[model samples]
Target: MIDIVLLSLLVVIAIAIIRMKDLFAVVMLTGIYGLLSASFFVAMDAVDVAFTEAAVGAGISTLLMLVVITMTGRKEKSTRHKPLSALFVVMLTGGLLIYGTLDMPYFGSADAPIHKHTSPRYINDSMEEIGIPNIVTSVLASYRAFDTFGEVVVIFTAGIGVLTLLCVARSQKNDEEIDSINDSMHQQHLVIRIVAKMLIPFIFLFALYVQFHGDFGPGGGFQAGVIFASAIILYAMLFGLSTARKVINQTFVQVIAALGVLLYGSVGIVSLMNGGNFLDYNVLSSNPIAGQHLGILLIEWGVGCTVASVMVVIFFNFAGRRAFQQHKKQAQDKESSAC
Candidate 1:
């Protein structure tokens, strides 16, 4: 019953997002949708997935969308042309998805291929093989380590792509103009600043707890990384981007992001050197179980580093561009006033 309610709310939110002309409200509604999805995941007993959806989807993605809407206008422009082709495409895709679902096995069917094949091994053998109580952690960190590595690489590539496209060269402006622009961008919400400063330490602590406790609990690197990034983003919002940049510069972020991928690859390479296949953690230590534990820890750390750095880098680039544009507009206004 709760799931049905949440799903209905999600549908309503989706429709509202589509119909809303205000981009800011649409972004807020999208966050609401993410929260609802996370709630649904929790109800389905997928707590790890819920954690990720809440942190990344509802938290970081919403913040990014807000930044984007600030750069572009808040109001979506009206268009006269009908989106007939787009509507047709959407309808066709929806129909195909519904058709595909017809052939799928019922949820939790005993005859399902997943239950018959790898699921039994992961459930029964994971503790003996990987020495991890959490089968999800064992599967993600050991059974599918290569796939996780590829995901990390994809995130790194995406961050690089965004930086390449949006990290434009700053216009040559005098110190006075730059300082004035920075001053203007600085937020003056004293209450927010106090609350954020108080919460930031606890947030970082929780992120660390999530990062290290994944083997026993429903949290892991991906979720932890987004939580950490959210703290930084909140700091940037309350304090100012310049101050945040001073704390962790863009150059350092880029280097850390690269290092994370290198660290994951290095673990695999080391495993290969130890007479094992790539990502085979059994060879990392004298005790195979110990080796497995070590490998999972290292890989999870690498994933967290890459994800956190990439998120911060993307945010910095967007904030920088916004500042530059605002400065240019202010300069133009000043010139017009002089004329």
Candidate 2:
């Protein structure tokens, strides 16, 4: 019953998103949709996925979208092109996707191929093999460590791509007042600022707990990283970007991001040197279980570091770009008024 209701709400949100014209409202609705999706994940007992959806989808993604809207504009532009062809393509794709699922086993079927195959090993043997209480952590950080390494690399690459596109040159005139989108916000939201300052330290503490406590619980590096970045983002929102920059050096963040990837890769190389296959944790220590524990811990930390730094870097670049454009516009307005 809960599943049905959540699915229905998801469908409604999807339709609303398609129909909505106000980009700001659309972004807000999108965040709500993410929250609902995360709730659905929780109902399904996938708490780790729920945490990620809530943090990345509902929180970080929404902020990035809002920042982007500052440069793009508040309202969506009306297009002159007809939608008939696009509609036809979408219908075709949807039909094909539904068709593709026809031969799949029903949800929660114990006899499903996945359950009969990999799930059994993960469920029954993972504890003995990996010595981790959490099977998801065992699978992701141990059995699938290579895949996780690739995921970390992908995140680092995305940060590099954003940096390339949105890199803003620092202004030479340190004393000149720069107009910022957050200036009015910081001044107007005194209560929010006070409450956020109080909450920020607790948020950081929770992020650290999530980062290190994954072996026995629902959270791991990815969720923890986003949660950590979010606290800094909140600070920047309340205190202004310049102050946040002083607190967190952009160059140091970039370095940390790179080092994280290196750390993950280094574990694999060390395993190889120890006469084990790449990412084989068994070779790290005489006791296989201890090696697994050590390897998982290191890689998870690497993932956390990379993810947190990348998220912050992306936010900083987007916010900085928006500030630059605003400053340029203000300067142009002043010049025109003088003329």
Candidate 3:
């Protein structure tokens, strides 16, 4: 019943997002949709997935969209409705997707091929093989560590791509303008600043807990990294971007992001050096189980570092771009006034 209700809400939110022209409201609704989706994931007993959706989908994603809106403006440009054409494409796509699923086994069917072939092995032997209570972690960190490494590389590449495309050249004048803007925000929100300052520490602590506790609980590097990035985001929001940048040097953050991918790859290379398959943690130490534990721990750290740094880098670039644009506009206005 709860799942049904949540699904209904998700549908409604999706339609609402499609119809809405106010970009800010749409961003907010998108965040709400993410939260609802997270709730549904929880209902489906996928708590780890839920944690990620809540952090990335609802939290960091929303903040990033909001930052983007600062430059893009609040309202969407109106476009002529193409209802018939859009509807036709949507219907065709939906039909094909549904048709594709027609021959699949029923959801959670015990007789499914996956259950017979793959899941049983993981379910029955993963504890003994990987020696971790959380089968999900074992599968992710050990069984499919290469895939996870690829995912980290993808994220790292995306951060580099965004930086290349959107990064502005910083100057002394731009920095002053950014500082002034932050000062204005800082002075206006005394209570928020105090409350956020209090919460930021706890948030960081929780992120670290999630980072290290995934072996036993419903959290891991990806989720923890987002949560950590979110704290920095919150600090920037309350204290100002200039101050945040001062504390977290952009050059250092970029280096850390690269280091994370290197760290994950290094583990795989080391495994090969040990005469084991790439990312095969069994050979990292004399005791296979101990090696598995160490490898998982290291790779999870790599994931955490990369994810957190990329998120911060993206936010910093967006916020800095906004500041630069604002400064340019101000200069233009001053010239016009002088004329």
Candidate 4:
């Protein structure tokens, strides 16, 4: 009865949120949707998945989308109410989901086909095949390590995409131009700068812990990279881009970011060459355990570097573009005066 009520409330909220016309309201509703979905997942006993959805959808994803919305402005004008392509896509996907569900075991059945088949093998063989205590981790890092590696590649690609889309290099030029146009707009915050400087080192140390502690807990490359990048972003926001650049040079940062991906890819290639399958980390060290540890470490570091550098690059580019724009404007002003 409680489940039914909660589910009904979720449905009602979803309808209300969907009817919201304001884009700002929609963004807020997205957060609400994330929270509700996470709640539902938790109720279903999928805590890990729920935690991820809550953090990503509510925290990072929403923040990122808000930033983009602020940068790009609210909304595009609608051409028509009819969305034939959208309708077709939705219909096709719904049809597929229904078709798949039709063959699925009945909900809450103890003797369901799902439980009767393959479940025993998973319960029994997991210990020997993977040799890990935690079945989930064993599956993710060992048995299904390939899938996780693919995900890491996708993350690396996304970092590259963000840098490219945001015109990180051009940001410097933009910054100069902004300064020129808004010369009187320059504001100082010495207190914040000092505070940020004090915290920067500690922030980085925590990021290191998160990156290295993935074997035992929920921390990992994705979290570590984002945390490190966020610290730099904070520094820039508080102190100024010039100060941030002094700490992390643009050219060197880009090289490290590229190197991270190369490092990860190289490990896989090395394993392939060592007579084991691709990414078979057993070749990294004499002991299988040591090799697995080494591989995880290398891959995690690669992920951290790429995530941190690419994020910083995006922030720098945005800030840089403003600076360049300001600089250009100043030059124009001087030329006009000379005329």
lDDT of 4 by residue, 170-199 (tens): 455555544444433434666776788899
- Per-residue CA lDDT of model 1 for 1-339, tens digit only, reads 898899999999988988999999999998999999999999988999999999988998999999999988899898899999999999999999999999999975789876787789899999999998878889999999999999999999999999998886654453346556556656457777888899999999999999999999998888888899889999887667776777887899899999989999999999999999999999999999999999999999999999999999999899888877877798899999999
User: Candidate 1, which ten residues in sequence have the lowest lDDT sum?
Assistant: 170-179
Candidate 3, residue 200: how far the Cα is off, in Å: 0.8
* Highest TM-score against the true fold, candidate: 3
Candidate 3: segments with Cα more than 4 A from true spot:
none
Sort every candidate by TM-score, greatest first: 3, 2, 1, 4
TM-score of each: 0.94, 0.96, 0.96, 0.72
True-structure Cα RMSD, model 2: 1.6
Residue 135 accuracy (lDDT) in model 2 = 90
- Candidate RMSDs in Å, in order, are 2.0, 1.6, 1.4, 4.8
List the lowest-lDDT window of 10 residues for candidate 3.
107-116
lDDT: which is higher, 1 or 3?
Answer: 3
Off by over 4 Å in 2: 172-176, 179-185
lDDT of 3 at 111: 85
